[model samples]
Every structure is written in C-alpha cells, then in structure tokens.
Target: MTSGPASSPITDELLVGALELERTDRGVLPHRLPAWARAQCFGGQAEGAQLAMAEAQPAGVRLALRTAATTVELDVVRTRKLYRGVPPRPDGVYDLLIDGKLAAQATATGGDAIHIDMSTGESHVERGPAATLTFTDLPAGEKDVELWLPHNEQAELVDLRADAPVAPVPRTGRRVWLHHGSSISQGSNAASASATWPAVAAASADVDLLNLGYSGAMMLDPFVARIFRDTPADALSLEIGINIVNGDTMRTRTFTPAVHGFLDTIREGHPTTPLSVVSPLYCPIHEDTPGPGTFDVEALREGRIRFTATGDPAEAKAGRLTLTVIRDALRRIVEQRSTHDPNLFYVDGLDLYGPADHDELPLPDALHPDDESHRRIGQRFAQRAFTA
Candidate 1:
C-alpha cells in the first residue's frame, strides 16, 4: 500500500492572482488588494466594510503546483456571509484543474459563519472548526495542477497534503491582463472562481489575469487609479458605469473629469498599452432610470430578495446618472480621447449582456448575472477584446 499523504505548508510562492497574504492564527488569508490599499480603508466607515469584504473574497486566486500525486487534500477555514432574514449563501466552491483543464470541484464543510443584519448593518461572527477537502484518483504521471479557491468566500489556508511532493509551477511568461470592475467582474453569481467572466476570458485569450473587481467599491477612487498606474500590465480594461450608477456615486460634471483623470493616471505608467474602457452591462432597472437602488421589502417578506431603482427617470435629465446616460457619456469620452490615444478602445457593455439576452437569462436579483450569463459574457468578451 502507498504511504499516507505527506503534509506541506502553504506558501506565497505557490499562490497566483493574490496580491498579498495575511498570517492568521489558524492559517494564511489571501488578499486581492495589497496592504497599502487595505490600509486606506481605515476611518472610512461607510465604504470600509464593503471594501474589506469584497477584497478578501479572492475571486481569481488559486494555488499552482506540480505533483505526481494521485490524491490531494487541502485544509481550510472558510467564513461565509449570511443575512438574518434571507437564505444563507451557499458555500464557495473550490475548482481543481490538471494540465490546464478543469478536473474536479468540491466545497469545504464546517467553518466559521458571519451573520449580518441587512436592515441595521450590524454583523456578528461565530467561530467553527476547519474543513478538509480531498480529491482522489488522478491521472498517474506528474502534471501541473491548480486549486482555485472560492470566489465569494473568505478562506484561510491551513494545510496541504499530497501523496507525493509538490513544487511550484514555473511561470509561463503569458501576457498579463489587468482588469478592474465591480461585482459582476468579481464573480458575483458565477458558479466558481475559475468561471468568473474575467477568468473565463483570460483562459480563452491565453493570458494571465489580474482582477481588481471589488463588489460595490469601483467608484473611480484616486487610490484605485494609483493602483492601476503602479501595477505592470500588458493589457488593461475597466468595467465602469454599473457601480457608479448603482450607487448614484457621481454626476456628469464630476464623472466626466474623473474618467479623464483616471485614464490619464493609468496612461502615465502604461502609455501605449491596449486599454479598453468598458461601459456597464444591460441592467434593466437602471438602464433608463437613475438609481440609489433599494431592496424590495415586499419580496424580502416573501423570503426572496430583489432590487428596484428608487430614482426617477426625470432625474437623468437633471444630470443624475443612469446606465443610459453613463453609456452615452462613456462613448463620447472614448471617442474624444481616441484622437490622441490611439491605443485606447471602448467596449459597449450592452453587447456583453443586452436587453435581448436579458429576456432569456434575466438576472435573478435584477442586478447580477447568473452562471450561464457569466459564460456568455466571458466568451463574448474574449472574442471582442482579445481577438480584435
């Protein structure tokens, strides 16, 4: 009989798509934003909590290694969010890929839980035991393997075990595509981490991905522009407008200049990079109406959560931003800037998920896309942005 699997400590060198790792009492917590960016959250109580949760979810993170082991095991402590009246969100999925193809998928058992009061904005956490996820009966010889962590869960890696020793996979020198957007790009409603639209697009385009998609937090902050200016990327894109309209964050006066400033900062570093400015996807509720989106309390009473825009359509004429207004402004801005910025590109977000597709694959909550929509968007984005 073969000997028991050998244990290995998880390390930074084996991780991909995470900017930093924090050591916790139980294990290492992967962070998409570096320490400097996380540090800025302090004192901004309103946006801080949302940003904290979004960045810690590790939407595109995974562990890459080469091993001959036919069996593998990973120990993790996962923290999931739960709303008081709503159903608990499902546990995040871990996807195992061998030789660049999806091989298997699994979810961790018992772990910590966080319950949040949506109405009061209060939260409490309860500690629980760690979980071990195992994968067995792999193909015999050594092969490159990747264990993609949950895109929507906060996971702390405790330990790793394999039937044979594991080593880091050598970098493949692939072109790096750095993308920034809101929850849609962060894998909201996607089936798994590897299935996030950006992840799927990167795979199809044969490029490495750096996803800076923060749920509810892509408001064109100066710090985020600085992050873009600093990071090295072969290609860059920004999925703007949705979060801006969702939050009703900026008006035309402020948004127009902010977009210019944001692009200028990125160009400071990536002067000639192929940069694409992506507008918001087709969101029916906010397509024509201005928003400060609100929850459907009636639906909440029925144990279903839904969102509805509270702002009036007339507000758009008064300079309040809606998806339509934002899209128009974005298109004009891209056209005006393209005269001097030859490398800049504009991608109409509606083309990714427009009204026609919405009728067939309507967003369950009236905001985020479902699994199938994510697949189509990713595939379409690959064709539009990468192929062209």
Candidate 2:
C-alpha cells in the first residue's frame, strides 16, 4: 500500500452533527450531547450511564471537507458493546461520501470491546489498539467529502492522512433541523450512518441535521430539554413515546405534563420554530401492553436477541401507558397547544410506519425497523415535515 501524505489535524470546523468534541488520551471523541448535559450522567448510575453511552455513538456526526486527494486514511479507536451470552453485535460501519453521494465504506478492526452481563447489568472494557481505515482512487478533482461516523458504536477519530491538503467545506446555507428521538432515530438496525431515518430525512429534505436520538433513553429528561433549549435550529422534531412506554418510566398523569415541560423548555429558545411532536410507530408488542420491556431470555439463550413486554395489559385501565395510549395523549397535547402556538404540530408516528406498512417490512427485532422500513419512514417524514 502506498503511504499517504502528511496528517491533517482534525479540528472543530471540519465536523458536523456533533455538539461537542472531547479530547481523549488516544484521540478526539465526538459527542452528540453537549458537555453540560453529559455532566449529568454517571457511569455508576444506571440511567446516567445509558445516556452517556447513547450520546457517545455520534449518530449524525461526520467530517466534511474539500479535497483533491485520490487516497484518504483515517485512524480511529472504536469501542463496541457486546453481551456476554447473546449473539455478538456487528462492527460499526464508516461511510464515505463524495460530492453528496456515497463513494465507499469501511470498518475499523481491533480497537476495543465492552463486555456486558445482561442479567447483572455489569460491564467491563477490554483495551485494543487503534485501526487505520483507508479509501483509495477518488475521482481526481477537488470535491466535497463527508466521512460519516458509525451511528452504533463509540469512535475516537485518532488521525487523518490524505494525498492532498484538505480544507473545510464552505457553508451551503441549508436550514438546520435538530431532532431528538429513540433508538430508531439513533439508527438502531439501519445499514449505515446516513441510512438512519433521521439522516435520510435530512438529506432528502435538503437540510443540515443535528440528531440527538438516545437509544432507550428518550425519557423527556430535563437535561435533554435544556440541550434543545440552548441549541440553535430553524426547525425541530421529537420522536417520542416508544422509549417512554417500553421503559415504563411514567404513566399518563406524569407523561402528559412532562411532554408539556419538554416543549416548554424548547420554546423558550425557539418560540416560533416549526416543531413536530411525533408519537410512537405501530408496535404490536406494546400497543396495548404496559412495559417494562424485558429481554427474551429464551431467545438470548438460543443466541438470538429479542424483546418482549412484561407489564400486564389490564394495567392500561389504570392509566398505564401503551403505544395506543401514548399516541392518543400526544395528539391531544398537540391539538391543545397548537391553538396558541401555530408552529407546534403533531405527526402521528403511524403515518410513518403503521400496521399496513409493518405487514410488509416488519421490524427485525420486533422493535427497531429494518433498513427498508427506515427508508420508508425517512421518506414519509421528509414529505410530511419538510415539504408539507
């Protein structure tokens, strides 16, 4: 292999979609949540640790520059989470885009690993060396380049080397759309970084994206609301309900006001911005069942991963939340709020992925959507929220 040219220092100007950059002993880590928000998470704290892990995945984050280089190399220290007994998770994918189109893809090998005991909720990390990812044979002219980081794993961008000097991409004046949601929005089972529904929607809608989708952690936290409140955006959207319901964190009495408070915080910063409050998609498992969703131990022992709701269906009568209950409440909230705040709107998640669509493109894990479903949802969301 031909040795690439001198290394270029990765700077803040070259990154997009990340809210903060953390300098680590090995490299710089991209964070979707600002440092202040991350400060609230503690490794020893269950919910706090989950938020920290989710935010570090860098869902919509990418390095963008203009270069004439025919070869590009990026060194990274990647850390992936694995279950002790369940099937291993796939390696995170890195997508390289040239002039707005996907040109190539790569994955770093032998970086680091986190082994978790599902039953005990304990985890430990195994250290590994950094890996170099190289892409060769570009079109041989100055072009805009985007290196989208993995949306499912933690990656520390160690260094960059290229055949030619690179400069930051000039601003395109695209409207920025900041969104927050659950795992589906975090690209759960999506094929690549840009394939995540939110990323796809932003691209199709021709807007810049700032994705703050934390898997299993979208509980309308005050810190999260504060992040949205402080961030700048032309438009905003929230994919709420699934994480709340499945986590079984709150009932209607608490959830309704929490939604109001979340929106209230955001509106403090962006009073008139177009904000869409989206409810959960059609999840049959949680449609009428209250959760505290649990791992399917049988499936896990068989080396398959699956989730099943554990809450009683009868609990719905006592204001316990289900997908159906959440959706109805969200609709009413939007209707009531829209009278005074016209920019605030509601998009039923069913419109994006309902029963009819589910019949054809079922969620692979009975939770997260498959790649095709993500595409469909992205297309529908772009049309409903952007074009409309």
Candidate 3:
C-alpha cells in the first residue's frame, strides 16, 4: 500500500463502503455481513469457507476519491472460482466514475483461480501472475472518482497508487436506502458492480445504498432483520420468495410468522421509514411447483448446468411454500399492515418481471436473470418503487 513521498499509504483511506475490511495473509478481504451477523451465520460452528467466499465478494463496495491525478493504479489479488464444464464468469468490473459519471472500466488480467469439481464439490487453487489495473489521462482538477469493485469476484486490495495524492470524497448527503434479498439481488449474473439491479435503482433514486443481497442466503432470518433494525437507513425494501422456495427451509405456517417478525424487527428502529415488500419475480419453474430446487441432472448430463424444482406443486397445499403461495401470502401481509401503517407498501415482483418477462427474457438457468433482464428489472424498479 505505497504512496507519494509526503503522503500516507493510499490503501489507508480507500473509501470502502458497506464493507468491513479484514486483513488477511493475501491482503484484505471485504465482508458485507458485519461481525455479529457473521457469528450468527456460523452459529458457534466453524466459520464456513464457502459462506465466507460468498460474503467476501464485495457487490456494492467501492473506492471513492476526490483527486487530481493523471494516472492511478490499483493492486488487487483476486480469487476467482471456476466451475467444471461451465465457462468462467466474467472478471469483476472496475467501473470508474469521475465527477459522478462512469468514465472507464477495467479488469485485472491476472489473479489466482480456484477450480471446483462440480460433482465432488472440491476445490484446488492455482497461483497466478500479479496484475495491476492502471487508469490514465484523467482530467486535472479535483474530481470525485469511484472505482466500483466487481460484484462476482473475491478481490483483495494490496495497494492503490496515483500520480498525485488522493483524498476521500465527501458524501453526497443522499438518503440511505437499505435493501436485502437473494442471489438475484446479490447479483448472480450481473456483469458489474455498478450495473447490479440494486446499484442501478439506487443511482436512479439518488440514495446512498447499503445492499445486503447475500446470494442463497436471504432466508427471512431474524438476524438479518435485526441488522436492519440497527442500520441507519432512511428507507428499506426486501425481495423475498425465491430463496424461501429454493431452500425449502420452512412451511407456510412458519413462514408467515417469520415474515411478520422480520418486519417487526426493522420497524423497531425505522418505525416511519418507507418500507417496500417485493414478492418474487415470475419464474416458471417455481411459480406453481414447490422447491427444494436441485441441479438439473439431465441438463448436467448434457454438459449444461441448470436447476429444477424437486417438490410437486400439489405439496403447496400441504404447507410447502411455492412462489405462488409466497406471493399471495406477502400481498396479504402487506395489505393488512398497510391499512394501519400507511408507509408500508407492496410491489408485485411481477411488475418488475412477470409472465410476460419470463416469456421473453426466459431465465437461462431457470433461476437467475441474464444481464439484459437485470437492466430491465433495475429500470422498472427505479420507475415503480424508488423515490424520495
């Protein structure tokens, strides 16, 4: 973490947002979930590496600097996961915003790659050459510049360098909007950090954002709700259903109370803040069928990875929750609450992506939306839900 002769180490003031940086032997790992939530995530068990990997991918973290430098360089050690038979996902994008507008994008050409056997779920790491992302030819005057981290990769920052010294940018004084959801919100297939649906909506709504979209996690957990209860947020939104269905973790009897409890906890701290409850997007596979979603064995046999619901739609009546069941429950819950709590609202996930969208956009994995769908969902969410 070097710096100019007169300045402190640039890494010391790297402007990490919504991430708690923990130093590691490699460098620094950015964790979205705080220490307490992390403890709860582990629950006195061993700190699970797989869960650690997921939370360490800094989906909304960035380095914002107000500086006058013609050239800037960032040293990053990225640990990328490679699944067998699946082409590698794109490198995490570094979106550079100068004066509040995207001016450039780049990716580190070298990093460590960990290959995982799909069948065995075992991983092996191969060390790779070092690479530095360099940005040059910047305008001279002091300007707000943000380097958005890749939403998909595990990036460890070793150093930051600039031709001139850098200073942290002041906040924009926008209201802070906190959001939570599943992989779709965590940015499953999104191309970049700034392009993630939540980031896009936050930009449109002009809010400082804290994204708690942990992939395969948003289980309507009490700890998550407690996190919201304590965070300083001017508004809140939760995208529910998909994860509940996929994990098959609970029946409707338990889910109803969980949703109510989740909301009650948030209301403890943010009694009057506008809160929006979003149902799941239209997913054909899970709309009627119950889940316990599993890998598509047939597709995997054909060398393609996909997901399928193992639970029958008939099981929904037996208390197993389907997307359809969850949506209806959420609508009813929000409707009942909104009569007395006028600030509460419900946005049908169908409005963001519905039967029409599922038809046209067709989730390729039968789970997550593609980049184009992400753009459309983000745009629609901004227009429909995000507002002062």
Best model per lDDT:
2
User: Looking at candidate 3, what is the lDDT of residue 239?
Assistant: 98
Give the residue spans of candidate 1 off by over 4 A.
1-3
Model 2 spans with C-alpha error above 4 angstroms: 1-3
Runs of candidate 3 exceeding 4 Å displacement: 1-13, 43-50, 301-303
Q: What TM-score would candidate 3 get against the native? A: 0.92
Each candidate: RMSD? 1.5, 1.7, 2.8
- Residue-wise lDDT of candidate 3 within 1-388, one digit each (tens)? 3234232253535655554778777666777877777877787553345455667788878888887876788888888988887757777888898876888899887789999897787879998765788888888777878888888887888777787778887665768888999889978878788888988888887777778887777788787898899888888899998988988988999998999999999999999999999999988889888888988888877867689999888888899999889999999999988988999999899999898888888898899998888888888887877643
> Candidate 3, residue 13: CA error in Å?
6.0
Looking at model 2, residue 48 earns an lDDT score of 83
Displacement of residue 137 (Cα, Å) in model 1 is 0.8
TM-score against native, each model: 0.97, 0.97, 0.92
Total clashing pairs for each candidate: 0, 0, 0
Q: Against the unseen true structure, what C-alpha lDDT does each candidate score?
A: 0.90, 0.91, 0.82
Ordered from best to worst lDDT, the candidate numbers read 2, 1, 3
Winning candidate number (TM-score): 2
